[model samples]
Target: MYRKIFIDDENAAHRELSIYRKGHVNAIRLNDEGYFVYQSLPISAHNYAALFHYNSIDALNALPFISETKNGLDSWDEAYLPNTLLEKLIGILGDELDAHRETKPEEIMLGWQDSPEKISYWRVISPTEFCSFLESLMAFVKEAQTTGYDLEFIL
Candidate 1:
């Protein structure tokens, strides 16, 4: 069984995104000090942005749309891969695919944490949780999956 954790306060939520995508499979890890951001122009007028805080390259691969490209690695960090590897990865992430039309909200504040710092600063955050946090949520997901309710989303 997967572990389940709660993000009940400010500190936990702040570290949620970065920790969730730490080490996945084929995703890239760009260094932004305190953040992970990915953007694309999908034939649309405005570019979409997905930001987070990740731990390892494998965790990054679990991101949405990263597996439907031409080389699979276009979304991966080119700086970290060889020329041949980059080409192969791009093909995997950007293949012949239509743009996604799902209109889920950008920010989802699942819950909060118990911090003595402030009055639980209310703010929106990514849908998934960090490593420490996801262990708990994953359990909920497993249960939900049995009920035919899927709650997967991309930043």
Candidate 2:
């Protein structure tokens, strides 16, 4: 699945470009739609706390209805398995394996961060739609290698 994090609105590309001018974070165009995509080594360390740094419960609740899949529920705590895209995504990603096994009996906070100065977010997407989105995104990237793009999640 394509993984991503949301930081904030960048009003001017040139202004935001300065953040990466020093090469601390590698920059890649998400697609061709002009949305910035910052490439970082996929989060694996940091003790799983990074996952909670970018997810927002309010944002999640505002998303569209996502069909619950058996696979998505298998990895989530029973309390979280009722119905929701988060549960579905967890079920799909954790299939045959524990997605949040350590957090049993409780819901896991999948990466998000909040602050008065700035807001940042991260999300784990289901592999099921990863390929299709990649293909579509590839087509966009091929069209405009220099332009950035945004990948919107449809649940």
Candidate 3:
């Protein structure tokens, strides 16, 4: 079971993404169609805070919910990721994926994310799994773009 976040518009995915505190096994359901699976790494380092740059991740993390994930409260935090930012993220993540293909997962690391810390799952993530995560995110972003809606994380 999980708590949910809300939105003001109609086109947004309201209660799609699942957030599990025990692990990072997350999935997003686009508009009631189906589930998009993105598996987890060894440890739940940052728990997706390692996906974006400073401003974006910080904005998401700054939301009240992220701070209380461990409390198991009925609290909520905003998860509105705008399409404009996702546009840039797509290219950056794509480049990292390509680099990983050319080099090794350990070599490239999570070079896409800004300021990856020692607490991150950088050491345990595989190239295939990382690419899978990127692919799922790209699909979600593309769906949001097609619908002319900003991506909303149902955290």
Reference-based lDDT, each prediction: 0.29, 0.29, 0.38
Model 3: lDDT of residue 1: 18
Query: Can you write out model 2's per-residue Cα lDDT over 1-155, one digit (the tens) per residue?
Result: 23334322243442242221111112343334664544321222121222222232222333342224422211121112112233333333333223233332322233333433333333333332333333333343233333332222211
Candidate 1: tens digits of C-alpha lDDT, residues 1-155: 22234333345554454322222221223333543323211110011122221222233243332233333223223223322233333332232111122323344333334553322222333323232233333343344334333232222
Which candidate should be chosen as best, given lDDT against the real structure?
3
Which segments of candidate 3 are over 4 A away from where they belong? 1-79, 103-123, 153-155
| Position 9, candidate 3: lDDT | 21
Superposition-based RMSD of candidate 1 using all C-alpha atoms, in angstroms? 16.3
Best by TM-score: 3
Cα RMSD to the true fold for all candidates: 16.3, 18.1, 14.8
| lDDT, candidate 1, at 21 | 26
Model 1 TM-score? 0.25
